[model samples]
Target: MPLPKESHYTLADVLSWEEPDRVELIDGAPVMMAPPSRAHQEILTELTRQLANYLEGKQCRVYPAPFAVRLFERPGDRPEDVRTLVEPDISVVCDRDKLDEVGCKGAPDLIIEILSPSSLRHDRLTKYNLYQRAGVREYWIVDPSARSIQSFVLESGHYTAKDLGTPGDVLKVHVLDGCFIDLSKVFPEAGV
Candidate 1:
């Protein structure tokens, strides 16, 4: 189901709300998040595990949602005035300055989102444009049902290259050197 968007809200509004359902603010609109499916969780786990292992003892860190990411926030931006907030299924932040108690205050080095039926369009197009505009360096969209991944790497502030791969392939994280995710482990049941 597409998330309901009845009223406009800001970072301050989101921070103040105590609702149970997780949501993301897109240009001041709230997008309700649905729970992940078993397959989605499985892929997310393997991907997060791989990224975490590679990041251990390193400066960069990986976080799985519900980690808030204020992608467009800049210096002196007020919470009530600033609007965009996102929760990538996986977020990798190399800049420690952006880290805060509220979550990441700026665009993460890399972001990964595992697709669900209700969120397929939102993730593929809406979030895709948002992340690209926010200057997220690398973004990956994983289709759990399809057992495939579509990757976009930013070049010259635009996503210039696209990499599509299946469960048997290996994907290198451009933001993290010497780091890779084994696709087979991400969706072990794909080839069976």
Candidate 2:
């Protein structure tokens, strides 16, 4: 079971935390993160590599996990009021202004979350609604155990499920034009 949230945390509090554990602030609460498995790391590495290669010389850039993202529900919310902070497995940002020395100030163009046993619910439900509410253009949920990738595109302030690909399929990123990832390489050793 997940640990009880420390509900008083904000982005500043999360940043000032002395504990070494990986964590994220969700709706003014602190949620501890589990260490990723080997398969999770491998998948993240490959996806980062592919995204970086595809975005070369482009205005947009991709960032791997441990990068902070502050999501606000309203446009003019103060820093203290902006509570949600996430470290997505992969994030692509096209708006250069959103990038700062600390982290991303707003939603990224694309956010990808790799599902682990510990994060399945939060990623699929909590973060799904959070990203959609914050106006994220695209979201990808990559399930290593299930060997599947699900893509969602934001339309009319809501997410529309666009593609669900298995190991043998290739998935195109709607946010990143002219870029597609081969699912075979995404889940190797699996006969799909």
C-alpha lDDT values of all predictions:
0.87, 0.87
> Candidate 2 — which residues are off by over 4 angstroms?
1-6, 73-79, 190-192
TM-score each candidate.
0.93, 0.91
Overall local distance difference test of candidate 2:
0.87
TM-score of 1: 0.93
What is the per-residue lDDT of model 1 for residues 1-192, given as tens digits with 9 covering 90 to 100? 333455788888777666546888899988888888877887888999999999999999999989999999998888997788899999999999999998999899999999999898999999999999999999999998788898899998888667787878998888888988899888786345
Candidate 2 residue lDDT tens string, 11-121: 666555566467788877778888999899988998888889999999999999989898663456556776788889999999998887767888999999999999999
Model 1 lDDT, full chain set: 0.87
* Candidate 2, residue 121: how far the Cα is off, in Å: 0.6
Q: Which ten residues in a row have the lowest lDDT in candidate 1?
A: 1-10
Number of the predicted model whose TM-score against the real structure is largest: 1
